[model samples]
Target: MQLLLIASEVFPFSRTGGLADVMAALPESLVRLGVDVTVLSPWWQSLHGQPTEVWRGSVPHGGRLQPGAVRVGEVRAAGVRYLFLGTPDFERPGLYAEDDVERFLRWGNLVLPTLQSMGLTFDLVHGHDWAAGTVVAHARAAGLRSVYTIHNLQYQGRWNFAEGAAWSGLPAAMLPDAEFYGDLNLMKAGLVFSDHVTTVSPTYAREITTREYGEGLEGVLQARDAAGALTGILNGLDLDRWNPAADPDVLPMTARSGKPANVAALRAEFLLDDAPILSAVSRLVSQKGLDLLVEALPDVTRDWNVVVLGSGDPLLEAALKGWAQHPRVRYVSGMNEALAHRLYAGSDAFCMPSRFEPCGLSQMISMRYGTLPVVRETGGLVDSVPSDVGFRFSGGGAGDLSAALHAARLAWDDRPGWQARVARGMALDFSWEASARRYVDVYRQVLGA
Candidate 1:
C-alpha cells in the first residue's frame, strides 16, 4: 500500500518534541511492514543535510499563487522517502512560527498538487496534529482516504475567522467545519472531514471525548467516535535508538546484573552521596506536572538525590535553577542525548508526573534502560507501566506524587525486589514493529483491502 505521512516536525532532521520522534519512527516502521510510505514536512532552519529538489510549484494563497519548492530526502534508517516543502515562510529558526496557521495552510494547499507533479499516488494521506490537519481535509475533498492523528489537542491552531478566510484560500462552501466560534480551528477540520481520527493512546483517545481533556473540541470528537471514525493506538519506541544493550554510552549490564558502575559514575559526576537517585528528563512546563514536582521537592530532597535535564518555560526554568542550589538536587538546562542515555542507565527511578500525557517516550526509554518509572496513572503511562514493573499515582497533585516517590524508595531498599522490577521493565517490549503492524491493520480497515 502507498501512504503519505504529513507532520510539522521529524526527528534527526528537525525536532522540537515527541511528535518529531513519532513521525521519524512510524514511517520507517510502516515501510518494514511492506507499505510504501512518503513523509511531508516543512524545511525548518534547523534541518540538517540538504535534500535535492524533486519538484517546484506554487500554491494558491490570498487570490494569488505563492511560490514553493518540494525537496526529496531519504531516512537511511527507515529506507523511506521524505519530501520537504520549502518556502520563505517556513525558513525560520523554530519549528513553529507566529503565523503557523497561514504557513501550514499554504503547505496543505500544495500537498496534492505536489504529489501529482511527482507522479506519486498514495492509498492513504495521514496527517499529524493541527499543522497538517488541512492536508487531511484536502485529501478527503478529493475523495481519497485520509487519517488524522491528534498528538496533542491543546494546540488547535485557532485564528481569527476573517484573517483565516482571507489567507486560507479554501472554498466558500467548506467554511462551517473550518470555523468554530468565529475562529478558524484547523484541528476541527481534521476531526470533522477525515475518514478516521486517531490519538497516541487509547486512554487519551477516550479522554479527548470529554470536556476535561478535549481542549474545547470534545463535542466534535464525541460525534466522530459515535460515527465509528475514532481510534486510539498506543505509540511505539525506536528500539534501535534507545536500546540499552547496544547503546555505547550505557554501562554493560545484563538483565540479571545491576547497573552499579553507572550509578556510581552519576553520583560522582553530580557530587551526590550514596542516596537513591531520582531523575527526570522533560521540558519544564505545567503540562508535564513540574509544579507538582516543585511542590514535593522539599520532602523528596530529604530522601533521594534528584537530577533533571531539559529546558522550557523561562519562569519554570528560573524556579528549577533556584532549586538547583539544594545539595541533593542538580539541574541541566538542555537536552543532551548522550547524558540522557547515561542518566537513564544510572538512575534508580525515572519520574514522569504529566497532568495528561498522550504517549510519552521517556517512560518507555527509562524502562528500556532498566530504570523503573514513577508516573501519574494517566494516558500512555498507565498503559505501558504495570504495577509489577513500576510505581503509579492517580491524582495530579504534590501529595500523590510524594506518596508514589516514597513507595519507589521503599521498593529501592528491597534490593531483590528492585532488581526483579528492573528486570521485568527491561524485558517488556515497546518496539515499533508491533505498533507498525497495528497501523497496517488500520490502513486495511480504512481501504477495505
Candidate 2:
C-alpha cells in the first residue's frame, strides 16, 4: 500500500519531541513491511539532509496578493521518501510560536499539490497531530481517505477563531469542528473529519472518552467510539537505534550478559562514585509531573544518586538546576540524543511520571537497555510497562509521586528481583513491525479492503 504521512516533526532531520521520533521510525518499519510510505514535513533552515528533488512553491490564502512561498524537498531516508515542505517562517529558531497556524496552513497546503504536480499518488493520507490535520481536512474535502492519530489530546491547538478563519481561508460554515469554547481547536477538526481516529494506547483511547480524561473533547471521542471509528494502538520502539547490544551511546551490552559491565561503565561516565544511579531524560514540564518528581527527590536522593537531562519550562529548569547542586544530584540542561541513550543504558533505573502520556518512548527505550522504569500508572506507561516489568504508582498527584519513588527504591534494594524485572523488560519486544502491521490494517479498513 502507498501512504502519505504528514507530521509536524521528524527525527534526525527535524525534531522537538517524541512525535518526531515516532514519525522517523514508523515510516521505516512500514517500508520494511512492503508498504510505500512518504512523509511530509516543513524544511527549517537548520535542516541539513540530502534530498533527491527540491521545488519552490507558493500557497495563497484569503486572496492575498503575495502568497507564502516555501522550498519543498524530497529526500529518501532509511528506505522511506521524505517530502520536506519548508517556509521562511520555519527557517526561524522556534518551530511553534506566534502565527503558528498561518505557517502550518501554508506548509499543509503545499503538501498534496506539490506531490500532484510531481505526479505522485497515494492510497491513504495519515496526519499526525493538529498541525498536520489541515492536510487531512483538505483531503477529506476533496474526497480522499485519511487517518488522524491523536498523540496527545491535551495539546488541542486552540486559538482565536477570527485569526484561524482568516488564516485558513475556510468559511465559518466549514469550521464547525474547529470551534471550541469560542476558539478554533485544530485537533478537534482532525478528530471529526478524518476517516479514522486513533490514540497511542487502548487504555488512553478509553480514558479520553471519559469526562475526567477527555480535556473537554471526550464527548467528541465518545461519539466516534459510538460510531466505531476510534482505535488505540501502542506505539513501538525503533529497535535499531534503541538496542543496548548495538547502541553506540553506551558500552555495548545485551539483556543477558552485559549488565555488570554496562552498569559499571555508566557509573564511571556519569561520576557516580559507588552510589546507585537513577536518571530521568524528559522535558521539565508540569504535564510530565516534574514538580512531583522534584518534591519526591529529597527523599529518594538521600539514598540514590540522580542525573537529569532535558530542557523546558524555565521555572522547572531553574528548580532542577538548583537541586542539581545537591551532593547526589546532577542536572544537564537541554536535549541530547546520545546522552539520552547513555542514561537509558547506564542508569540503575529510569523515571517517567507523566500526568497523562499518550505513548512514552523513553520508558520503552529504558526497558530495552534493562533500565527499570519508575512511572505513574497512566496512558502508555500503563500499557507498556507492567508491574513485573517495572515500578509504578497509581493515580496522578504528589501522593502518587512519593509512592512510586518508594516502590522504585524497594525494587532497587531487592537485587535478585530487580534483575529479574530488568531482564524481563529487556526481553519485551516493542519493534515497529507490530505497529506497521496495525497501520496497514487501518489502511485496508479505510479502503474497504
Per-candidate TM-score against the hidden true structure: 0.96, 0.95
Report the Cα lDDT for candidate 2.
0.82
Candidate 1 residues lying further than 4 Å off, grouped into runs, are 59-77
Clashing residue pairs, backbone N/CA/C < 3 A, model 1 = none
Question: Can you write out model 2's per-residue Cα lDDT over 125-223, one digit (the tens) per residue?
Answer: 999998976788778876889999999888877768787766665546668776899987788888988999988888899999998789999999999
Q: Estimate, for each residue in 139-209, the C-alpha lDDT of model 1 and write its tens digit.
A: 87778998889999988988888877666656777767888899988899888878889989999999999
Question: Cα lDDT of all candidates, in order?
Answer: 0.85, 0.82
Model 1 whole-model lDDT (C-alpha atoms): 0.85
| Model 2 spans > 4 angstroms off | 50-52, 59-68
Candidate with maximal lDDT? 1
| lDDT (C-alpha) at residue 370 in model 1 | 83
Best by TM-score: 1
